[model samples]
Target chain A: MDNKLSEICKQLDQLALDILKLCEEQVKCRVKLEEAMKPGFVHIAKSRYIMGNRTVCSLQLPTEDSAEFDALTTVVPQESITDSEHRGFKLVETPKGQDTSGKSVLRRRKEKPESDASTEAKEENVKTYVDPIKWFGVLVPQNLKMAQNCFQSVLPLVVECANVQGELQRVQMKYQKLLKEKELLS
Target chain B: MAIHSAIKGKLISVIGDEDTCVGFLLGGVGEINKNRQPNFLVVDKHTSVGEIEECFKRFVKRDDIDIILINQNIAEMVRHCIESHTQPIPAVLEIPSKDHPYDASKDSILRRAKGMFNPEDMK
Candidate 1:
């Protein structure tokens, strides 16, 4: 049919586009890989970049030339040390001399060891508020209702697919029967 | 048993010589889609390697097809694509045809499995 032909043409067009994209991607990746495998790249593969083990490809190793190198020191310059100190917060002066005591000791009133009433209140709150089992029971019914609704929505589509599969099985049976008949006739 | 049940919902696609194709089709592996493209491709001497490669690519992309069986020789024509395919689902299998016997050394999947077992291959 014309519809079938057109559909095939459309599929062919899509397939062609997919193949084009895949080939382009393959070429891009391959070119990138080839570029990386070249002599100058990080991994200097001996097989591709060399002829003989005795003969070195690059006369000099990648190490920095001593001619370009100079001796270095661990000594911190006085100016840099001063710069480091300056980078920190401006030192705050104590509010107009209440007490300039070097040791401004902080001491608190010893905490109330525990009021039995507060302890009992905490125990009561724990017992009343945080019964996990009770919370689970409350949420279960609502979750079950949601799950049932979800299953109800999905069931029709599942049934339709099953029906189509059953139809396909019937067609397959018929095809098998025809083949059997042909075998007998032959 | 699991594979049997799984395959019942999914179709097997084939690409092979005419005789090989006919044998599988008779075994009830052949299917035509709504768009009128067959799940099986029959490759004759006249069939180009490019066409075989295209059909192989199409079969790999089809979600409905779960397994692909190609003639070992025919598979060689599209070896690059087959080796590149890493997905376990829609597994690609190379089978021998009348003209060409199966070569264990050349089969990519078999070679991969062998490599897995060989300790030196790990290096």
Candidate 2:
């Protein structure tokens, strides 16, 4: 009977360890999902600009307020210029090391000589300097949803891990008690 | 658990002795796979810092990798590369090796936590 009890206790200990391992595994999975979802926080810094069908949302760093917009102009890549009338926009690369502050600076290259009559050649050249807008900052809704799902999915696993840890503690206490009893009996 | 997922599908490129890498491998702690996601990579001690840094630069650019685990000793060698990374992805975690056990006094996380909880005690 004593031998049978010892075997049963051993089995219980193994079961507890297995449960603990499973719980740990679940917790790990949850954490990884959380890390992947971190970029979704960029939504907190979102800025939106709409031009026809192109609705651009920008995430301003440090803070999301429009007040911080000036600071972001330096950081964002300059791809194109937009005019106040929302027309005559031209694609030009911003000069390197040029500071974007106070008055806007405009440097237009000398007009090239046109040899042949082409529709592209007839286009007007307007020198306008608009602040470079940061385009990548928009909070991706899909990423945010995925992050939420990951957080929810990990909750059960965390509970299981806790339960297993609790069971292990109980078994450890019982094992100690049994050892003491055996010592007294001997 | 947070540590595990932060490193999932990400490569943990280590540069140290064989024993240290083996110890971690035996512990079954690195490179956990989940829900059809690709298994995280663990570069053993044999890899070089340059190779690791190059991989790190590329890894951070990718959406797949979230965390990077490196032996602290090896990380120290390429501190500039590690510090200069702009992307928040592939968060770098420095771990102790078999030869060098983790010293709380030297760990930045512990130092930061201590500063937050017991500001006076730090002095």
- Give each model's whole-structure lDDT: 0.43, 0.36
Global CA lDDT of candidate 1, please?
Answer: 0.43
Clashing pairs in 1: none
List where candidate 1 sits over 4 angstroms from the true fold: A1-186, B1-8, B117-123
Indicate the worst ten consecutive residues by lDDT in candidate 1 chain B: B114-123
Error (Å) of candidate 1 at residue A149 is 48
Comparing only chain B with the true structure, the TM-scores of all models are: 0.86, 0.51
Top TM-score model: 1
The number of the candidate with the highest lDDT is: 1
lDDT of 2 at A7: 61
User: Relative to the unseen true structure, what is the C-alpha lDDT of residue B102 in candidate 2, on a scale of 0 to 100?
Assistant: 41
Q: How many residue pairs in model 1 have overlapping backbones?
A: 0
lDDT of 2 by residue, A1-186 (tens): 687556655654564455445445434543443343233223211212122212322111112222211110011111225532211111112333333323222222445465455734443221122222222223433433332333333223323322333333344444446545544543
Candidate 1 per-residue C-alpha lDDT over B20-119 given as tens digits, one digit per residue, 9 for 90 to 100: 5533443233444445566777787789989988888888898866567777798888899898976554556666665675565666644543343233
TM-score of chain A of 2: 0.31
